[model samples]
Target: MTELEADCSRCVGLCCVVPAFGRSADFAIDKPARTPCPHLGGDHLCTIHEVLPERGFRGCTVYDCFGAGQFVVQDLFGGAAPSPAMFDAFEVVERLHELLWYLADARSRPEAAPLHDEVDGLRDRVSAAARSPHDVDVTVLQSRCGALLDEVSGLVRAGGPSLRHADLAGRDLREEDLYAADLRGAVLIGADLRGVDLGPADLLGADLRDARVAGADLSQALFLTRLQVRAAR
Candidate 1:
């Protein structure tokens, strides 16, 4: 797709499926998978398009689908409208795509990287499910995918210089040291912070979902987990 057409308007709101939301510090409401946003329409368009921030949907405004949704729908699914089977595929694919973005952001790649073997294996399973005439159990795929991403994220978070409130989304920082620094309210939507040290630091209300911190240290980080962190930002 051309740059202009590559924008989210061509997609079927896939980002909304890949991740989740709660009444957290970032989101003002709670929502579940495949459930249209109260402001979204049957056409998959946001009704509160212009006033999202004012309407308490700042996270929604900042989301970028990266053309994955349209690619899956038009290219993989043969340009047909989403079927129940396609919808199930969309959920798993969208989630994987979001995780791919997270890994990319954590590693600072200009484009999405190939999934780790573990993740690739999970992708294969999801693919098999997509081919099935009936819907597959996405929960198992979702859980396994989450685990693999977490495993790969540790390698992604390594070797970065100390980052403080860095706009490091979509980059990897596996096993990196960010100890005792200021990261207050940083936009880290798709970052990998696995096994990184964030102790005695300031991460007041930073975004952490879709972010990996599985082996990382967050002890003494002010308002880190105690404060709610939203996904899909």
Candidate 2:
């Protein structure tokens, strides 16, 4: 199995919490922060696993915690026991994943090319942390991921664009705009690109295993998964 798959299977649905959602195209109702979905069982598995999309849970279907949830739930807590500490830590993991996704998206732009090495280094560190057997300092990692994301956000808001070699492992880019973007030799394992506009995008030699791209428009995107395309909307 791919590393992403192995990592994802270890989660306990922490992504469902730590983020707020509204009754809209992507979700069915108003979901508050740190609250579990109505469809999630006590065991932390989605009750509507087979038909999450049809039930207005498309966002849930495309979300991936990259084993962060699993590691936190099983490795750190030794089970799915609920606790204030675990919830707090889960919040940080959620933020870290969000920042990682933002950085990954920025890396696809030309302006973030100079920071590709830094992004890769961060990915390696985070991946290692995800695989660790102990609990991590969520605050520290959140700060680290937040800083990079802030840097990229500043560049993007400033209209600076540059794309080259990048690394985007375990990032989340759900419903982001990536039209005609260049992502050569990038590592994009476990990213959520659902409904992304990838028209004319270049994805040569990019690793896209376990990426959730349910509604992504990849009409001219290069080297994507045939299985992903077949499975997506």
Question: Each candidate's lDDT (Cα)?
Answer: 0.56, 0.60
Name model 1 segments beyond 4 Å from true: 1-6, 14-32, 102-233
The best candidate in terms of lDDT: 2
Worst 10 residues of 2 by lDDT: 1-10
What CA root-mean-square deviation does each model show from the true structure?
10.3, 10.1
For the record, the alpha-carbon RMSD of candidate 1 to the native fold, in angstroms, is: 10.3
Q: How does candidate 1 score on lDDT?
A: 0.56
The TM-score values for the models, in the order shown, are 0.44, 0.49
What does candidate 1's lDDT look like per residue over 21-137, in tens digits? Answer: 887654678988656567766676777779877877777755554445676677678777656556666655554444343333323321225444444456556555544424556
- In TM-score terms, candidate 2 sits at 0.49
lDDT of 2 by residue, 76-175 (tens): 6787666767777665554454445444555565656777787778866765565452466757775786577545544433432234356666777764
Residue 115, model 2: lDDT of 75
With candidate 2 superimposed using the best TM-score fit, by how many Å does residue 226's alpha carbon deviate from the native?
13
Stretches of candidate 2 above 4 Å error? 1-10, 94-232
